[model samples]
Target: MTIAPSRSPAPSGATWQRADWASSFRNVGTELADVAVTASRGTIPAELCGSLYRNGPGRLERGGQWVHHPFDGDGMITALRFEGGEARLSNRFVRTEGWQAEESAGRFVYRGVFGTQKPGGALANAFDLRLKNIANTHVVRLGDQLLALWEAAEPHALDPHSLETRGLSRLDGVLKPGEAFSAHPRFDPGHRGAPRMVTFGVKSGPRSTIRLMEFATADDPAAGVQAGQLLAERHDTMAGFAFLHDFAITPNWAVFLQNAMAFNPLPYVLGQKGAAQCLASKPGEIGRFFLVPRPGSAAAERHAKPLEVPAPEGFVFHHLNAFEDEATGELVLDSIFYADFPSIGPGDDFRSVDFEAIPEGQLKRCRIDLERAATDPAGAVSSDWLEQRCCEFATVHPARQGREARFAWMAVTEQERGNAPLQAIEKLDLSSGERRVWCAGARSFVSEPVMVPRAGTGSEAASGPEDDGWLLCVVWNGARCASDLVILNAHDLSEQAVLELPLAIPHGLHGSWVAA
Candidate 1:
């Protein structure tokens, strides 16, 4: 089914400007408890019942000092609950140890990983290698616990209902203190049996080590089994510094791309620049794809070593999905690739960043022949462009994860090309290369779109069309000076409802949908 490219028209008399986009970064100071929200445009779906949780850097300044980057700001979580054709909103800040300490002192005592330094000069900030757990990247509900995750440190647990902080969690002792747990996790729909969650952590250095872990879900059919019980764990060490943020997985293999980038921590150690700003791409360097076998797969016993295949020149922060083609014996990976690493310099203001100056993420498809990889590794991999437009934060139906999928929903730029703020939600048909977009307006901006399948359509007992669902997205209403929860029909990019939010949520990094 081919869907021709089309876009929803902007609101009458609405004009887009840099200031309109910048207004979304303002700090939301107050927290609300169960505030009812009303739809301003359409009626809410009666069948849609669940909670949408989002996390991001909410507070940008403290003690009259602004963070050098938005990523350095404090983490805030927003919960939007829908039930019986009604919705209520609530938000709270995760009270990490660092957040509590700074609140009591009423000053900047910790240096941020993204270049927010204390009042004292370089002497005071120098050589302090302690990393404060910001807990600002992503949120996930595993079994009975809700965890706010940061890639650099342990996740902070919170009450799934009240949004209250429950302190740091060690995954029931699966993790130790101060260990790195990744923010991005892939949910496998269980090709073999019960579903499982797959995640990884990295300890990067001259020789980087990656620890891959899998956990059983609370929805397992087994009686009296606890959620988050570690199912499998494996550690692998590879050459070179690894700055991996996300990875892709199939039924049998976990795939990671090691970008050809060099990191120099001298400037960061001297308190002159952020740690991320110290990385630069290596010219003429080709990336590599590390394919590791899963714990209980057919390839696990025979291939105890990870196979490395040459990758195309680019950097990937996120992958859409991956699947193994049974007929061709090839593993297919779909990912968004940037020409280079995007960084904020010491003097650059994130609010005023030039979108055109940085590289845009374009989606690409790569196919690796497993049989050929065992012999001629260099020539086993091949790739081509899938979507050459400016887009990010893409997702497929939960049931189609790590499997062949035909549809994807993501936030995209309003224009056909070039880099800009994401202003619309796009539904792309991967089979036919067609797309449909629903734009809020010229001045409005958008966050990631989460696709929630309609109940009983696709589940363990049955299967349905991949696009039979709803797309929930948080949109910044620049004209209203607030935010809105925009809901669209997954079958077609049509507005189903728009719940006006009293408070504006800062542009978030990631979110998840939990069915009640």
Candidate 2:
């Protein structure tokens, strides 16, 4: 973990300009201000003070209709709820402004926030959850009931504490129009306690399935206005399956990553507008990895079957999760993407629009073995990508096992760059592949790493209640756009405590802590 470079001086900015097609790009912004003052854990502010939501993208209208991008939050905070220690956020006060985005047409999207232990008091008692379009994924509370799923071109169900809607389901035979519904409506929480919903569809055309629906909530909302049985089916794969992102489930098993038609991305955003006739019949994202099993009976269908993982003829594996390791029944499968960097050049725009030459991606650990993947769930156990440097945002800190199953992620190497800078925050000792970086450059864009367990210290015969894990995180500091919260020391993330958050929280994507 060697990060030394700090001659400082380069944080000025018009957001660090450089986009009109890269113009020869090279603004590592003073090694990203010495990797945010060495992964900042204390004083590091200057100007960039946080907050930047804007949500508006996905469009096509003009009568062709494709819209769908609403989630507005113009006031700020788009969705953050850390619970107990307090963090509840949801800004954008009811704005929608139609959708036709040429690039985020009207902006202002927030979509969620619902805390209650009295942190800042009434923001309508916290529980807004917007989205007249887009906003699909991660609202799910189930157990006190709070859930949402929308695609706008029709497919709704909101009411995470009164974001109110409760029913719409018109996939008109099942999804079409520019397709966009990546499933995150998951919740199995056990049999009679009731809670099960899983949706995944991203088909722009022929054959691309993964639909599993089942909502429950009936006590007679007028004989049925919302909840209970939509049961929608569809899942019989292998035919060059089309796009199907992130997935992970375990009440038996249900994993996904299908992508063949070149792992489609809407033909590279319609080939960046020139609409190259369909980019030679599309195949522009490169994909592979499909494993499904989990329906019931026969020992849970022999522990869920259906497997096919094969890639390494050009690389392409993004996000995917499932980490069940009950005394080695083994299922660990984390992921990450962006490849090609044999020294960068293809399309070169300064290593492809500054994503910094890709490669610096890897952290694959597989060992499925569910009764030999139930007869070849892709031939069970074996894979790699175990860290070669240049990583980005990895996470797996649910705290488990005989300790030592922690991972923190967020690296940069080559002495940090700018506008994206993240320099260090490692920690992966998984069985002994050893790694440790406990902070190196303050606020370089962190956001995901919430463990926070530390209470009694576990083991009083183990039933569930003995703490020792703290990690929490927020980082950011994009030249002071502000952000800090840190808390480290989950068995030594280098013992820390930063805090400092009064406001300035605009860059968000994945978050959830709940341990109040």
Candidate 3:
């Protein structure tokens, strides 16, 4: 597939702004997809987290490239901020022990070609002993401390402003043995109870199990962590499920998603033997979901009954945003899923991996309509997953603070053998289960569009009146030249605006928006 040009015709009745960092990479004619955005402080690096805070649609202003340093790891840039003409970013990269590239075995050779599983031929013959630098699960800022939970690595204390690791919790027996952990961080501002910390862990062994933990940030800092009292734990083993992708939390309930690790699919695709041989499994694997009570309360149970989710094997997730609907106390979850593995194989060159088959990617919406999970909590996925052979890489956008209005944006590709070519952005109505492709072409693959709320549309229009509910998206034109950012109306997905950057961005991952 050809990477589109970095320019587009401006859309009607829509306004767009291109940041400064979108012009650095030379788009090498491959569609730049999987673009995610977030707001943060400090220089956002070129990797996933750094790119989130990248300046869109402009030339890299001298030191802009310096924002994304060499050390940063893969994590979501969920938040970002740009002020005084400088961009700052913030997010957590899980740090796990013995899980780096050096630890991974030699690259997996399929059909005489090699796919990068790790750097070395084998750990015994490898040069770097450190393996790969594992990242953090999910982290959030609470006053001065940035609380993050990891299955294998130590829980780090980072300065929210500088994004530096200042201290770490001496995690000893609390960490369960596994390939990785699942618990993601969330900020629960106290409304009825004290603040709580929620996390999940995957314990690996003959039988893999998923564990959930909850604790408090304001508890006595001098007091040593109490395994039974300081946290709540839950375990489950259906299909030997352990790995969890992303999760969502409401005031009273927490939602869990399994196997949502998008860009980090190396371990899963490499098989358990490959994973164990190389220490690729950090904590969580085989994505599964659970629901537990928020930490720091009288009702806290030592091991809360984890309401399981309906995530199946071989389906990986990206993120899950949970919200409570007024009409029903039940929680609604919006998520993105990669239904099946693309039959990808490495070419003679490392620059590209070819897909053996075209993926019919899909976006799914599931609602937990009961107080407790009925049937198998591990089976909470929507019915669509049972039918579609393949699904798209998708992002969920909630509109007007209502679940009914939530939208799912996906880039569904045309199926090929090893890798299917991603084609267009299909907008799905969560409530109706209907989908529409606002923009589609074999030459292009659209990233998650930035759903910008127009300002002063009486705050209810909330997205702003400038375009009356619109989406500002970076559409990568597959042209040999630069790429483009196109804005569309969120309500219609039909009206569009194109903003052309002066240069092309090399194929990258997620990015976010910053209101200047």
Candidate 4:
């Protein structure tokens, strides 16, 4: 699910802007059939031969009734393919059982996790335990499967080239019926050959159960993955119920930070609030982290004996990257953290959220000392602010996934300070204190940066020089009510190209770059 800030009690600042932003809030129901995009600005890089795939909520409403929250919307697959100095675009909705049923009925027939209730309210929603398999969170290519994933349910497979739904995938039976697979999986860059994917799923209850998985494929010399295969699997149980979205993985460890948010199903059971809306962060509680040894590693025994540490996990939704410092032996994990749980109220609408009341995520770097954590919890770790500006969805070069990299990219608010809509992209230097930003005009909305290394620069020496390629991101053009794929030179954050589309794609959550 998307961790968007809840609606603030106060209204947006007085001098209200025009409602033209409603265009972006509208659903882009159009499914363009591989439309060739002509560059509106600079030329497309000739060496850029790959497809940039993005996933997020597309169809936000049914039968003229808006969803209680954007997370209730249906997942849309957007593909931007580049080859021989040209780009082609195609989009389609993930036709899951829930999406198809709602489309056929022309109204909401299921209760949403956030707050959308049945039209008949209490009577229509009470005693209903069915959850919609809305595969709107993320998209990933595992082996030959291009899966549209939702953390709570099995992934829906789709055709990579045509964005066609191919039914729910079972990962070759790796996942049983109704089994969950997390959407946010970490890529182990330090793996010998091909990068190993590390992901986890949770079954929360009195004795919460967590399963960790590892997958890999043969490293293609050309950087194109042929197929993925599962390598390892491990399951362990925790003490209490927990909420988890993303995790950080090192060479030998996978770290999960469990938030202190409590879920009271009383309201949900009584058909008053949705499941997600009933979660509230407990006061005066410092969350903890569960560090398990990664599967297929020398320290595999440590998987059953996870190291525990007190952390300000508060409500961390995403981990940018993590790795162990060779000299210090300290595990450094950088994450996007918020001050409190991003709560969803029953009547809240994210689009109408008050900027003043929302707490923005700041980039934080935490240093973990296992030996110290074993003796005293307080001295086990130390955290320092890396960048204070409100930021989220920070990404780095793919080669630097499990290592300390010099550069990081993120979507940030346009203003110099305070929280607002994301209208700019920032490049932060991890080693030095320098920062660079590329602002997408005042009215444009930019998504996460997908860094694609230039062709022929696949060698370690070439990628070591950070920013040797291009950054691809989607920017919503408010004036034209369309979207543009803006390509920026990673080195200096200069605009390289802009490919505009005829229709606007709703702001999305996560995206990936798969080489052709």
Which predicted model would earn the best lDDT?
1
Models ranked on lDDT: 1, 4, 3, 2
The best-first sequence of candidates by TM-score reads 1, 4, 3, 2
Per residue, candidate 3 scores C-alpha lDDT tens digits across 1-516 of 222222233344322112222222331222222323232212221221221232221211121121111112222222343333233323322223322222142221111101233323344223322223233234444334544444344555555444445545434456533334443444343424444455555654445565556555455456654322334555555344234545666655566654533333343344311221222222344555655554443224433555666554445445435666668655565555553543333222212323443334444546665444556454444433311323343544423322234555555443322234443455555555565555333344455565554434543344443224445444455543444455555555664444444335433343433232
**TM-score of each model, in listed order:** 0.96, 0.28, 0.54, 0.93
Query: Against the true structure, whose TM-score is highest?
Result: 1
When 2 and 4 are scored with lDDT, the better candidate is 4
Look at candidate 4 and tell me the lDDT of residue 424: 75
Which pairs of residues have clashing backbones in candidate 4?
143-228
Model 3 lDDT-worst window of ten? 59-68
lDDT of each: 0.87, 0.40, 0.41, 0.81
lDDT of 2 by residue, 28-116 (tens): 11101001122233422222122212111112122222111112211111333343333333322112222223125333222221111
Q: How close to the true structure is residue 301 of candidate 1, measured as C-alpha lDDT?
A: 81
Residue 459 of model 1, lDDT score: 61
